[model samples]
Target chain A: MPREDVEDLELELLLEALYRHYGYDFREYARASIKRRMWRRMMEEGLATLSGLQERVLHDPACMERLLLDLSINVTSMFRDPTFYRAVRDKIVPLLRTYPFIRIWNPGCSTGEETYSLAILLREEGLESRARIYATDINAAVLQQAKEGIFPLDRMQEFTHNYLRYGGRCSFSDYYKVYGDRARFDPSLLEHAVFAQHNLVSDASFNEFNLIVCRNVMIYFDRALQDKVHDLFYRSLVRSGVLALGHKESIRFTSHADAYEELDRQEKLYRRVL
Target chain B: MVVGGSWGGLDALGQLVALLEEGCSLALAVALHRAADSPEGAMVSYLQSRCPLPVAEAEDKDAIQPGRVYLAPADYHLLVEPGRFALSIDAPVHHSRPSIDVLFETAADAYEEASGAVILTGANDDGCRGIRHMKRRGGVTMVQDPCTAVRREMPDAAIATGAVDKVLPLDQIAAVLNGLGRA
Candidate 1:
């Protein structure tokens, strides 16, 4: 047998162990990405192989926590794609205003950058008082960061630029107060926001929402998992509810594709017509 | 698979495509750095017209077929997983979303010794680490010669890794790829 095949088997075993022991099912993640991350963890720990890394992780809970952080992609920024925000402001916000009350679910909201962006957008559009933003992620550590409402100060410039491009009304600096290397965002932005730990894979939907924004998260999952999440989102949304995905993600190949109408295809915004 | 980046990539890719024989069976995947907001399907249309082989943007979970060329969509990292191709919006690597290294590394893992990786015309050092992974996985690695490249930084970086097996000019790359397909 080849060494690569051996490593592959070891990886599968590790994922199974992670599922059985920790209730974290990464078994359906894109294999190549998982392997790359696992190998990186192995190198970081000075382990020679995936099996060695798995052994250490199984024995040490701290190691497992570190592994979880590695597996959960935390790459996000405030208004990362300004154009998507622009579309939400121009198209989605108007429809959202029609409702007397709004519930927005941001599943897989890593560190809550986009969630905060949405909150600010709602506040500017006079819908913050009537909106409830539920921000959830599989990782609790990132949830804690989201609740803190603080971000790196260096990123403020870029975030401000994105904010302006996305039709921000007030001075971007009004949203956050910088203290040295970190900026503490205004807590009022999250006044109606709820930060909680919710696993999209294993957990069931808790509430019906008017809008579901899950961007860039499903791309990490395999087809079956993607379909499962789509079903969950479909069920969680009210009729005519809006579903916004990352610019690259689409509902085209999913089972529920035909149920939704494209509100803005380029921005991946869809309305649940069925 | 063949990969290229920034400088001189358009011209080099055209030359490389022109050199290929009419019906090579090996499937090719190209990852190029593109702005996140670029018009969809533009690159695929442009490349399709220049190459004889059918060219298209790789869709998520699509089966990888032979005798076709797949271009990575902007803002997504193209990944090869067994018999199918997967797309990811996972954060950028080397500051590139459609990173050449991500594609090359995944291809190396999927095809192993049967894989062939090419690094060409780019201003950044994105594909260097990926080519090293390819060689370590017993795959063939090639880079466009720096002197012939519009920008030398990328090819030079790949060559600096010492994992490259060939450093061919743009005109010679397609013939080498054709030879590999036949082999």
Candidate 2:
């Protein structure tokens, strides 16, 4: 067989080992990004091939954890897409306020930047007192970091700029206090929030929610996996509940296209009308 | 097939995209750096207005179609798999979301020798490594002649690697694309 095919076979075996041993089913993740991350882990460990990297990861739990971090991409920032948040503030927040008690599920909430963004939005709109946010991810490490409410100080400038554009009412600096090179965000923002580990690939929905904010996460899953998760989200949402995805994602291609009506197509917010 | 451009890329890419006739019998994946908030549908509308082919902003897990142009959506990396396109929110490469390197490299891995990639006018060298990898995988590779490019650094960088199979001007590059290998 050709060398590239051999490399592909090695990656498949490694993914199998990762699943069989760790209960982490990355087999359905987008192949391009997953392969790139595996290659990065291999190079960082000074291994020349995927097979060698697989051996090390299978034997060392710590090595697997490192690979896990690489696999679960954390390329996020607070209110990264300011316009999306602006739309949420202008359109979705009013709907959220109607509920006597709001329940939001933020799956794949890596490191919780957007979750905190949502929390702050709630507090500003006077809905924080009755809102319950369940911020969950497949990786416990990110959840731990999310609970800490700290972020890199360098990213603050960009976050601040985004906050201003998203119509933040107060000074962006009011939320966090600096500690050395990092900024520890106000823990009170998460006062009604709960952080936990929940794998979207394997776990069942534990509770119905009034809103679901799963942005940029499904882009990493294959179509079949994306459909499965969308079904989960559909079932997890209450009647006329809101679902917000990343700007680029759409439900039109999936089986659930008719199951919901468009709330704001440009902003990728949908309302379940069926 | 895959094509990449940046900085003065709108005209360069639009010209190339316009060359993909309705019966071109080839799929084209394109990447160009664009702002996260580039006024929804404006870019696709502009590109579509210039070309006879159907122009689209790529979505995750989209099936690759022949005689169509797929533009990398803003703030996402467009990657190709066997017969489908995948999107990623992975960190930008070369400070560029929708990095040409990410698109071309994945295209090379997915299609191997069946792939054909063109590196056009760009300010940065994002497509160099990807085009190099394509050439090594026996895929056809080409670069727009630096002198003919609005931004020469990108094509010059690819030429410096000695992996480009051909270096041509804009008109000739479009001609070569018109005469695609039908991969």
Candidate 3:
């Protein structure tokens, strides 16, 4: 038998074992992505085989933690697409202005780039004072990084460029203090932000929000999982609240498409109409 | 040719595969970064339905052909010889077995000047080095414009290497491949 076929079966067995042994539900995620991540790590760590890696994961808590981090793709940058931020500033912020108090969800908020970016944007728009921002991810390593709010100083140039392109009204540097070789964002920006662990694949909705931005995160999920997260987003949104997706993700074919109208098609912004 | 990607890569691969014109003279194999649980055959089936070329799940030691798209089945590293596909129990590269780099490197050694490599939308820097190797060995290099990519990291990394010969939008990539087919 081909080793890949056997590895595929082993991966299925590993997923099952993980759920039975650890209660982390990843059975529904897109399989190929998962396999690639695991296989990539296996090569990096010098494991002899998939089963060998599985044995290590089953026995070692630290190993499993590392595996979880590897499985979660947390590549993100501040103000990733400036135009998307501008759309939020113009279209979503106005509606947020009407609500006396608001909650916003940033699901799969890797390394807190989008979380902090949203917080900074809301603070500038005078909405953070009355808003509660919940940023959740399955990766604890990235969450720790997010909480630090310390980014490489080398990235400042690019961040500044993206900020300007996204329609920043103030100097992008105004929001953060540059320390030695690192830029530490103002802690004040995070005053209303809550960083926590929430798995979109397994966690239940804990709070409803006036706006939910789950950008660039859902493409890793299979159609069923995407639909599940869409249901979670639909359940978590207040009627007439807004939803923002990454440039590629859409609710068009999902169950939630009817629940939201495309507010800005180019930016993938939507508002719950039903 | 070997292909690899994750996140926003599915549509990108579909377009790339569909662009392979009928009766073209090159054996193409793709290692799509996909989940082990998702149906691999469906993507091949989907591409087969659209393109005039044959598309299917790659089998071990399958003959490489022009005008064909062979997907690296989930969880395996797909390697290539001059005219055949090989599977490896060898470790994954950059955390992926059917790694784009592994395929590109091998194909670079084999196909050299005749090779054509494309890196599309993905969240990680998986294809950068692969595209570099392809170009180093005189293979044609094409990258999706990161600005328009759904997940720009892969193509962005390739462009950052200064190895990409052409960077086009996703919609325009098929035409380029079609043109190459005609040429």
Per lDDT, the best of the predicted structures is 2
TM-score of the candidate numbered 3? 0.67
Error of 3 at B166 (Å): 21
How much is the lDDT of residue A135 in candidate 3?
89
Superposed Cα deviation of residue A75, candidate 3 (Å): 1.2
Across B1-183, the per-residue lDDT of candidate 2 in tens digits comes to 898998888888877777666677778899988776566678889889888888898877889988888999887899999999988888889899888989999999999988988888888889989989999899999998999889999999989989999999877887787787343
Winner on DockQ (1 vs 2): 2
Docking class of 2: medium
| Model 2: fraction of the reference interface contacts it also forms | 0.76
- The C-alpha RMSD in Å for every predicted model, in order, reads 2.3, 1.6, 11.5
Instruction: Identify the CAPRI category of the predicted complex in candidate 3.
Output: incorrect
First chain TM-score, candidate 1: 0.98
Per-candidate chain B TM: 0.96, 0.95, 0.90
Error of 2 at A201 (Å): 0.8
> Fnat of the models, one by one?
0.50, 0.76, 0.00
Choose 1 or 2, whichever is better by TM-score.
2
Per-residue lDDT tens digits for candidate 1, residues A1-274, read 9877898899999999999989999999878878878887899999998899889998999998888878765567788778889899899989998999999999988787888899989988999999999999898888888889889899898888878878789988999998989999999999999998899999999999999999888878888999999999999999999999976678988999999999997889999999
> Candidate 1: which pairs clash?
none
The sequence of per-residue lDDT tens digits that candidate 1 reaches over residues B8-111 is 77677767776777688888888888776576777777777788888888877778888888888877889998888888766789889888988998999998
Tell me how far the alpha carbon of residue B95 in candidate 2 is from the true structure, in angstroms, after superposition. 1.7
True contacts kept of 1: 0.50
Poorly placed runs, candidate 2 (over 4 Å): B181-183
